[model samples]
Target: MTVDDSLSRGIGPVAMTVLPQAAADDDERAAAHWSGQLATFGLLEAAERHFRPAAEEGDLTAVKCLVWLARQDGREREAHSWLERAAGAGDAWAMYELGVSLPRPEGLEEAQRWFRRAAEAGHALAMNDLAALLARAGRREEAKDWYLRAAEAGVTTAMNNLAIQHVLGGDRAEAGRWFERAARAGHVDAMANLGRLRLEAGEEREAASWLGAAARAGHQGAAGLLAELPGAAEAAGEAGLP
Candidate 1:
């Protein structure tokens, strides 16, 4: 497949490469740190091996990692104990994870509480997630506020989501600006949205540029629109551009 075809929708689920940053002052913490490093290298089995010892010693981070691994293994119930332990220890990420682990409706109120706690602790992901929950609860204004905060905190997905909200509210100019910001940050959906917005504004050349970039960056929506872009067929036919 061509690079564009392979990435027609997304880059796919690449393993996270960022190791957790922490002061590894104890044996368990050190092991947790090492586990994170191993996971960063996609050595998940090895990372889990280290986490066993740390979790046995009651290291919350290690426990949390086990929860994630269990969830990935489709044993969602297995995550609860570790997640609850870590959350009880005041781990913000753990709290957020625990909230999401529960099924909604029955768990919605409790999840919101945990999400609020995590967001108050400055978790940008929690802020964005809580915003989603709030919006689902018919609190659009509150959700928009959190989206604004998360976007300002450099969450590109939040920027894109906020842009969509603006689009819904008929503030296309602001939506365009936010979409541009998110598109520049490598959000393919935002790139596609921006390309469509540009096309709607009668900027066919710029739309083509954005759409082409979006297609190459893994947005199928942009790829589908490529042939419809003004002068696109002419340019592609003349230059053999895919």
Candidate 2:
């Protein structure tokens, strides 16, 4: 199968079969699959062994695997090289990874460029991250637009961030709506934020409920806030709050 076809199918049953034959044949496609399996099992060295050969043979999937393996080994420069190679090949995830790996301050502009490319390529998380970069640069309107896109794409963090943007814009009602959506989607920060809003509005019961949920999910700030709420000690105990 072609590289693009293998990429589209991912590492499935077909890719997983006949490992011995694959190794004997030196099949780069099968090597990529084997590398993925090894990586999934936390066998980083073995994965790298397979990945290097396949990557050298021009397997973009293998190149991506090398990026992850390099990161795991704390080889940041090597990881960046692999990420750049895959991103240049039009891999959306690679572009996003490259953007995040770039050093802040000095690499901010380059990161933004990569994030925009990834987002334009339909990477939902990239949209959220790109929005955050814009927001940090004081581009509120543009940030809100990207955040809305990512939120609509079902990114829980984006939903939470979009809610924060609304809150900053003094739209409490809209903020609450988005916060609730993110909280219901299991975003811990959103639950805590929603709880705080409820507490400020004198809805102590609802605040406790949301804070308790966030606390149960291991949010220390939520646990602390929940502990301060009247009649919340028992709930905090039930949630094993720290």
Candidate 3:
């Protein structure tokens, strides 16, 4: 509710650094690909270098990248132009990004429309976002359905969120199953939550195991909780949880 779950997929740009040489070839599509790589690394200036050429050449991804960069620079008007350009061209990522970028108060309805457009286009991230919004609006059944669709489409965050919904519904076993599914996929939050659940159930050993893995994975909350367990540090090290 606070912000779009950019990290899950779609318009979420990854923080990266390396600029691939393969993406720098004479091909426009290749250049666009490189621009995305650069943008993912938070190398906006470098990303923009490639974005201009690719977007000018009509590369959809490059257009989306330009939108992302403009937003990062606080150029909302510029970003909107790029968003409109890409969306008009049927770029689902652009539609999804535009939805995420909309200003609140007047944004929710418009964002929902954009999300439906993108989701109908087979955008998994858009589906998940729409599901969250539906959930927030207290439409549990519809939210559950969308979450299932997204989770089945391999959105790990959807798996975690679905588990949360299960908890709210008092379906403890279902929650545990989904949490484990997400944790096994390397979801730190799911791992931590599962650890907490096990601890609450008096399954300290299982709790320590999950907490150890989440902690080694650099989840600070998991680490803090693990530290309070008897011999947890030594046990985690001995178990080679990392």
Point out the higher-scoring one by lDDT: 1 or 3.
3
lDDT of each: 0.72, 0.79, 0.75
Question: Could you say which candidate leads in lDDT?
Answer: 2
Candidate 2, position 42, lDDT: 49
Give one digit per residue, the lDDT tens place, for model 3 in 50-153. 56887888877666667656666677899899888888887776778788889896799889889888887878889899889889989998888888888889
| 40-75 per-residue lDDT for model 2 (tens digits) | 644556546656887888788677667656665678
The segments of candidate 1 whose C-alpha lies over 4 angstroms from its true place after superposition are 1-59, 62-78, 104-106, 233-242
lDDT of 1 by residue, 36-117 (tens): 4444444555445646787878887567667655554556677687778777887787777777767867988999999988
lDDT of 1 at 77: 70
lDDT of 3 at 183: 93
Clashing pairs in 2: none
Q: Please give the lDDT score for candidate 1.
A: 0.72
